[model samples]
Target: MEKIILASSSPRRKEILNRFNLNPLIVEAKIEEKKSYNESPEQVAMALAFEKALWVCNKFNNEEVVIGADTIVVLGNRILGKPKDEEDAFRILSLLNNKEHSVITGISIIRANTNIKIIDYESTLVRFRHLSEEQIKRYINTKEPMDKAGAYGIQGYGEVLVEKIDGCYSNVVGLPLGRLDYLLNKFFNIKIL
Candidate 1:
């Protein structure tokens, strides 16, 4: 088995990988996550994921496979990342109330000692139930929305706000297992399970 490196600090991603029975070396990738003007949500995510993977790849042996990922919530053309503060979280939740949004996650994999690279993205549509200001505030007070895109986490208390979803639930949480499985199989011939 090839040494696997996860170049992210997201607990959600780590948990998802663990659920697949894969344990990876965790390495935080320090990269500036700035969005490019006029870039599509998918492009922004892939770019950030690539940057993270490249950063970690430079620090490890070539025999390792470095994986990086970025996720964002898109409502119309607006992209919602992690909230800067509780106030921001409240505002994001307000906008998402009773609305459908898209969750886009970009994934990148790089061979540790080689120049091999792969990048792809998955998008999931999620609908939020009508939420009162009190409900949003209560959820925000829990602080669960502070660190998640769109001020909500599908696998946590944020699930209460979700009315429906039309794609991979894991993608909305952070990573898409189906997409990750395909990438691993295609590039490393590694199959989950």
Candidate 2:
């Protein structure tokens, strides 16, 4: 197998790739993730993903295939990012309580030597079960929601908070495995299988 590089420090993303037997070289991209209000959610996600991949791509040989991903939580037009503190986490969780929101992940794959690049996004609908203020506070105390978008991790203790999901489950976990496999096979002639 060719060397694969992951332009992210997200453990969830690394685990997702490892689950498919693709153990990518972990190289965190040193780029600022700035969301633009001028662009749509999908566009912002894809652009950030591409920038991350591109930043990492410049540091490696062209033979290396690099993957970059960014996940964002959207409630209506609002993009909920990682919480700044415990209070912010509470606010985010409160906003998501008993509501269905969109989880969008942007993915970018690039082979710098060939100048080949593919940028795409995946969207999943996640509905949170109704929760009391105490439940939200206890979950916040767990600190799992501090570093995650939407103030929840569907794969963690936060699992109990979700009523259901309408799309790719892995997307909510930070990567979309199906979309990733498709992109790799179609654009890079690489197969996760």
Candidate 3:
């Protein structure tokens, strides 16, 4: 088995890997997301994911495989990140109300001290049911939206707010485990199952 490192601090992402019975070394890659003016959502996500993986790999020069991922909620051309406050959360949910949005997660897997790398993205279409103000407020009171993209978490209470999803459910949760498994098998000869 190849030594694996996860370049993230997200418990959701950690749990996803845990489902595979793999306890990877968790390294927090401290890098601020600086949005480029002209980059698409896919580009932004991919670049950030790669940056995080590179950051961790640079720190430890060994035969370790590092995985980094970044996910964004996009409505039209706008990117909705984690909410700054309750008001912001309400605003995000309001925009998502009765609308179909895209959640794109970028994943990067790289081997330390080597040039082997895989950078890819998975996009999921999430449709939200029409939400009343009270419903939004109630969900906000749960505080589940504070730390999630688009101010909603499909894996938790936020699932009720979603009407349907057209793509990978795990992508909305944080990581696309199916896509991840393929990458692991393809690049590192590692398989989750």
The alpha-carbon lDDT assigned to residue 110 of candidate 1 equals 92
Model 3 per-residue lDDT tens digits across residues 18-81 = 8888788899999988878599999999999999999998987877999999999999999999
Please rank every candidate by lDDT, starting with the best.
2, 3, 1
Find the 10 residues in a row with the least total lDDT in model 1.
Answer: 15-24
Query: How accurate locally is residue 177 in candidate 1, as Cα lDDT from 0 to 100?
Result: 88
lDDT of 1 by residue, 1-193 (tens): 7788899999989887877778888999989899996899999999999999999999987578889999999999999889999999988999999999999999999998787899999999999999999999999988899889898888989889999999998899899889989999999888876
lDDT of 2 at 43: 97
Which stretch of 10 consecutive residues in model 3 shows the poorest summed lDDT?
A: 28-37
The local lDDT score (0 to 100) that residue 21 gets in candidate 3 is 81
Model 1 regions more than 4 Å off: none
Each prediction's Cα lDDT score?
Answer: 0.91, 0.95, 0.94
Tens digits of per-residue lDDT, candidate 2, 41-99, equal 99999999999999999999757999999999999999999999999999999999999
What is residue 28's positional error in candidate 1, in angstroms? Answer: 0.7
Q: Report clash pairs, candidate 3.
A: none
- Looking at candidate 2, the ten consecutive residues that score lowest on lDDT are 56-65
Clashes of each: 2, 0, 0
Where in model 2 is the C-alpha error above 4 Å? none
For model 2, state the Cα shift of residue 50 in Å: 0.4
